[model samples]
Target chain A: MTTQTKQRRKQALLHRTGSYGKGLLFMLPWLIGFCAFVVIPIGWSIFMSFNKVKIVPGGFKYEWLGLQNFRDAFLKDNNFPVDLITYFQEMLLMVPIIVIFALMISLMLNQRFPGRFIYRALFFLPVIFATGQVLSELFVQGAGEVPFIQQYNLETIVDQYVGPELAKTVMNVLEKVILILWYSGVQILIFIAGFQTISPTIYEAVRIDGASPWDSFWKITLPASIPFISLNVLYTIIDLFTFPQNPILKYIKENMIKVDTGYGYASAMAWIYFGFIFILIAVVLWLFERTMRTRRGRS
Target chain B: MLLSRLRRITFFDFALVLGFTALAAFMSLPIIFILNHAFKPTNELFLFPPRFFVQNPTFSNFEQLFLHATNATVPFSRYVFNSVVVVTMTLVSVIVVSTMAAYVLAKYRFHFKQIILSMITLSLMFAPETVGIPRYLIISGIHLNNTYLGHVLPALASPIAVFMLVGFISQIPNELLEAAKIDGASHVGIFARIVLPLSVPAIATISIFTFQGVWGDVETSTLFMQDETMRTLAFYVNSLLSGLQNSVAAQNVAAAAGLLMFIPNLIIFLLFQRKVLETMIHSGIK
Candidate 1:
């Protein structure tokens, strides 16, 4: 090679090596944490899923049961299927309600209006107020105020409007779902931000081309916001399972309190639950990827 | 014709704005309802027509909330303390660690770099919730339960934080780093003196969001901090409401407690509203 070419190659090699060293240094913390915490714990749980953990007064012991826990949770534990179904049913309604509301709010916030900032903040405030325990308190206390109503058993107009039957069903279904609206705060903010990022020029172009506001939204805003919508959907799905009031979580907590068992059964059950969630996530991601690819193709 | 077309657009804008305003009001009604109840007398709180405004607003509810904060059973103050410590520690650790990792990822062209970047991005979708049981087991085994380290340490290794910093760091021109390098600056020196200063805004954005996430999270801390005193503000608020549902005043106190727990996040949101909103948008985008 020519002297100039070799000299340039040497410079490139030095620069590359420097960045490599820096990257390795930077990644070390996450690498260490990921291995120590995430990957290993997942492996441990997979292993423990096959075992029965017995905790004596002083220490613990593990014996391989080999799918016994899974069988127990699925075939033996009658409550497991019911809890799983009820939980996903909540997800079915909650996810769509949150996404639609958040999208509508995002559209509104995107407009120029009086008290917009205050409205935005108010909408967002529930995220802070409606945290797990806090919202549970609110739910409990709010439900408590109806004691006299419950005592008198008022069959008032409002009761008829909300309806005792539907309300009870909603409460049953939403045992953990009502508090979920609070989570819309982040999703709303994200959608608004996404809406904001869509260039005004695109809207203007559509307008000049004689497209109506609805048309522009269909053509520009909605299309552009697809990626953000998918993200919010994913976030909502993950968050729904973490509700403290989740029957599965309650079951686990209840198990933890029992004198004989020390998180072994809970661990086994949780792993199964997580395995289902992983499959769901993979499907959702695949669907999102396909949708995006199709959208790109159509464009 | 042009005036008519413009008029149609204006009409559409007006209708759209009005429709959205109505929707916004409906969505915000729950918050407004809660706030109104929080400030009202217990009797008035449940009154017909559901009084939008509180009559004879009292500090009693707030006073009771603060009073409860002192109690050891709830340890509301300790919860707040735990939240502050965990959030602060997590933010600091995420910034330093993610920045170092991101610097290398952004500036380097190493083998396995693409794999590393993709793994981080993919992991962003996997929240702690999915892996909660295992994580709890891990923390329990390590005896990190009920400590600030348990609350804070896992949050530090966010894939999104690294990804965010990579985006910002990549935008930094190579010549700047090369000049420092030619000046006999070591990689660590270049990162500290050169890369760190330039990436302040990105760091600020990451830190604020990370703090918000950790501060507001009750699940992790609730699961880990079996001790009441070790709980974070979110869990304390939950406990207070759960603990006191009978007394009329206690209901009010619960609302106040909810509002109190909301205060720090509200303040953060207000102070760094633009930063938080912007970072959220950026994070959502990628």
Candidate 2:
């Protein structure tokens, strides 16, 4: 090789060595766990999905059973389909309600007001309190018997005496929204964090143009926060799906106890469910990206 | 006319503030409700009208929770201990590993830098629940089931921390690291003495998130630790509720137990609230 070529090759080797050395060293710990726990098992499960797994005295033995698990869950199992539909339906209602309510409270919390910090803490209290046990207990005890509601009931009793059915209807609406409102605290915090990132100068400029608060909110605040909203939507989906009371999770946990069913099939079923969620997330990300681009283009 | 206009703005402000205050109160009522039920006297808790506050409050329930917690049958303390050990181990492991990883990701002009970082970002979409069943089978097959190492080993490499810290560290000027190198500091030396100290804000952020995560996590503990003594606090609290929901007194006692479990998280929040919140706001800004 020419001297220049050799020199260039030497420099490239040094660069590559430094880069790979540092990168691998940094990733080593995570790579160890990931390879052992995540990558290998994921590959194993895919393999196991096509096999009949049997437990013997020594360990698990397997024989090939192509596509049967998938067939059973999809074609034969009636309950899986029912549970899947119900879960999606619940997600549809729950996600929107959480977003809107969280947005409303976050807007309110963003304003300078007395006891704002206390309110913030109070809102965060649900996060501290929403233990698996606590949620189960709250559901069983009924919201009426759940302490602070008892006080609200006293106020409603007075309202009932004054205007009966109208008051009842109003209170009922509040009650219907109560269970969900417990969890919106994190969503509110996230939104407020989003709102605070908006420069005050934007609102000031909008006001100079004689825009109404409503106009400023719609044109400025809402559009500015689309990114945060998308994030909140993703966070909420993950949170709600994993909630202790989520019927599908509860059902799966119940079935795990029976031990007659093989782990291989259960794992395959889980992967199939995960595939749906992956597609949903992809669609949302694509839509968000497109909207963000259009907005930037307009500006 | 000016007075009327001024009065109108003031009125609007007052109405707006009141509406927010009321709404905030409304939002917090359920949590407050849970707290009250958790602490109230047995008879008062069960009255037809229900009690907002106990006429005569008592700690017998809390006492019962603590007393029974260590019993072999309940394994409550064992669960608490397991949670503490696992969470602490995970927190320490993730911090050390992610810091090193993030330092390289931020500082080095490595091959596939963009691809590697983006891959880490993509991993966040795969929720723990989605991967949990396969994880369980793996743990069981490996004979790590019901073992402490089993619980701690799987989560040692948390992607969220790596993503967060990489973002935070990237903001640090490269000039700082170059200065350290000019002083003849080795990469490890610079990281230990310089990078970590300067990265306290990010460290604080990662710590709170990881701590809260491990504290409140119920699912992983449920999946991995089925042995009575191997259960985490979340599992114990869950088991206690179903096992002890018969009487008002027992329910209150269980609630007190639940509240006891919550105290540590509350304390952690109080201690690190400002730093953690600032880091969270900054980390989550994008």
Candidate 3:
């Protein structure tokens, strides 16, 4: 009876704490890892952004530079701002295309079919070889281009409308559509995993209620997958922004290594780049959350 | 009615099959080139017009690759071994750490939870390489430089993995977790017996990411370590390219190495694809 009373007091104490302690306990390892790896470095990066860093005997020597580095990135640097804008525009087009394609292919691949696994494997193989140098090599060898694109003389017609300069950019992206497919592998895997969470019984029940495949897709399949879609959108943006061939990254390193700009300027450029991405991601997440809330309210 | 409808082949299905076939054929082009190019002798690699298929396939490229590997200061297999150990260790740590944290973030309400969540989102904003100098310093400061810990430690804090797992783990019903609580299970028990098993698909997805990142890793090999023996196979392959830049023979040998390297990635994907299916049968419970 005394032991039972002791257990009851313990349970009451636990109820008061609301398992916050347990949550922290579970998150402990990652918390330590995060503080060690992420927090310190990010703090350093922020500090570095405002200071001139010189390589000394054992470590870097910092000389404070107020906002000069930031000013240089915005006012003095030509390529940094232009490359950042171009990357943003490219991602705005590419992210939606990749996500939608991932959804479609994953939906199909989720179906029961003969040789589906083989098809899935084939679609994903490019990701393995999509490492930078080899892909560029393949591109130089004309492997990423659709052969019919040139034969069709489509660029001439495109040039008539968008003008030559913009048309050339459009044509280049069109030619790299195969590489876009290569980029969708992770998105596809995420979508498929997400599709697993939706129960078949719900589909069956909806079917019994006389919904067509198309109707069920928009009403049932889509709403369930929105979170995964948002996740993919987030991943896609980050992936494209830091693309190995991204001129912005190259520009940052080039400026960092140069005597004129050095690490201060590069860090400044990086923070500028990060600020844009942070705003874009925050806005997208906010918009998505609003939609999610509306969907929940309707349900 | 649904089963019968499925049995009937519609023109829509036909169109879908055709579309998928076309996409697959298009996707397979580079793979075909890689497969054929790896077999071609040095002369054929640079043939004018660059023949799509090798007229005379040879194993000489593989031979050259192995011979070069053997002649390196540290044998090629040593680099391969280093990569395997690092990749395996990193994958295990990343999955375990990320999933445990994800379970809490997804289900538990705690003080500063919002901060942890935002921290993850923020980490994803900046490129990792931007912090290279500081991260290297931290590694060296911890006295982990030139060791496997340098390769494995930083990667364990994988925000994307945690993000993906939280997304996946959130799909598991709250009532189910509550039910386990009523059954007197500890957090560790619930995590091991329920959360881990239920979230196999997410694990598989993150495993593939971790494997690919560590396997093809350039930064760790180039940045953290001063010793050549501690470097990975990817660094070796990269060194080969730079060492023999502009050589036709190097092209074939690099192609051979590229082909060999990508197989592990492909196999990992295929293996995980099967794991993605394991939870579907049990997860229908809401």
Candidate 4:
């Protein structure tokens, strides 16, 4: 290359570095917070999980205990494993239901209609009340439950018709419908947002081509919203797992406060639980990516 | 044929409207139920087949709530003050920090931008509960426990806020920034005068979210603020509910407290619903 071209390239590189430095300077607060809050806390938790953490007169002491804490959580502690399995089972059922419901509702709300914003606001209303304490209190007070289900003796009726095990499962699913619907508020908002991103012209074109609404939904809307569906899946998973109602979190909270099962054991349980969540998220991302790739290839 | 088609369309729209109305009523029932229960007399609360409407509404619940607050050592206003201070501090800091960082991520081409963005995505997957123990450890270790900073600092750097702000700021026209730069605007000057002013809707959206999240939070406040006076209203109400179970007066007070905690959020939502919805759509576009 000519000398002038080389000099121009060098100047461009310098300019890029300068911008990089400026960007890093702007990101200083987050970097500091990430280190102090996230990085350090993660390291500390991992360190503490392998030790026996004791609270004393002033602060606490950590005595090295190797893999005993992990072993205790898996084998010695019955509640942690049961809680973890129950959480996984619940997530397996709830995640798809929440996502599909959100998608369906968003699709319904996305249509051009008068008072659309009112319906949107109505759907999003649960977000205002779906906080940890409020929801728990509402449930405790019997306000949040579907009133007629128990009053009508539906579970017993189902039990008589179906097998006992299936009846129990069906009843559990039925009971969770309200909870699931409430949890879908944000996901519905997200899906509505995603729905809005698809241009109207595509739908118009699909209509002119004689495609039915169902056909257009599958062909155009679903493919276009794949990214958002995955996003909602990740969100629903995280939200469900971390929700105040989660038995695993309740278990962790119970253990964290007690003098007998202080920070070390709780930290160990948390790490194990986090491992499950991480794996779940990874599998979700992988599945979505593969689906998207296949869809792209087909088209 | 045209008349028939128009009639069919109207019928479809009618069905759609009715369906949505029913769903809306179902969604709003809990809020209505809670508000109604707050007004019910002690005898009415236990009425079978549970009336949706209060037959004889009374202010006794509110009076009882106030009485209970007064009987408590710290008083109700203290919890309100604590919530206000912590939420405001966290809001101000989050806006300043997240906005600047978002501007850089959006407007500037930088090394490791992709990495930083991916890191944020990864961080979003980590549940707060998973980190609760270590978070408490850090707060106590830094001697911030029982202080507002302990309550505020851990949540100040919200990844979702940063992500949303980045999307919002990126939508601001580059030509505008270039023109401002040409007029001798420094980075800070451009951010303060141009980006910040143009991004009010986005800022408001984040503010409402941060406010609601911080206001409704109980676990952090409970963990950090051991002192009764420093606890937030949510934590206080939670404690009250647990401590005074089965008493009609306590139940009344709990419902009242729930309404009290909910009112600010409702007002915010009503005021900024448009802006918040617009921002959500815009973020989706990105």
Number of the top-ranking candidate, with TM-score as the measure: 4
lDDT of candidate 4 over B1-286, digit per residue (tens): 9887666566667888899998888878888888888889888888887899999999998999988989989888898889889888999999999999899989997777898888887777666765676778778888998888888888788887988898899999999999999999988899999999988889888988888888888878767778888888888888878876677547778878877877888888888877887787677346
Greater-DockQ candidate between 1 and 4:
4
Q: 1 or 4, which is superior by TM-score?
A: 4
> For each candidate, what is chain B's TM-score?
0.81, 0.83, 0.90, 0.92
Poorest 10 consecutive residues of model 3 chain A by lDDT?
A: A132-141
Task: Provide the TM-score for each candidate, comma-separated.
Answer: 0.76, 0.82, 0.83, 0.91
Q: Is candidate 2 or candidate 3 better by TM-score?
A: 3
The superposed Cα distance between candidate 2 and the true structure at residue A62, in angstroms, equals 3.2
How high is the TM-score of chain A in model 4? Answer: 0.87
Q: Where does candidate 1 chain B have its weakest 10-residue lDDT segment?
A: B122-131
User: What's the residue-level lDDT of B87 in candidate 3?
Assistant: 94
Candidate 3: where is the Cα deviation over 4 Å?
A1-19, A99-142, A145-157, A186-235, A283-299, B1-7, B171-186, B242-246, B277-286
Clashes of each: 4, 0, 0, 0
Query: For candidate 3, lDDT tens digit of each residue in B1-286?
Result: 9888667867766677778899998788887887787898878877875777989899988898999888878998899999999998999999999999999999998889999999897787678877777888899889988999999998899887887788778899989888998999988899999999988887987897788788877788888989999999878876776555566557877878877766787788678765544432222222
Candidate 1's error at B103, in angstroms?
3.3
The residue-level lDDT of candidate 2 at A236 comes to 79
lDDT leader = 4
Tens-digit lDDT track for model 4 on A1-299? 69999999999999878878988998999778876787777788889899998998877899999999999998898788876775576678779989999998888888866688888877877876687666887877877678678889898899998788566556766777778878888888888877777899999998999999999989899989999999899889988877777678778878977888788989888889888889988999899999988987988
Candidate 4 fraction of reference contacts recovered:
0.57
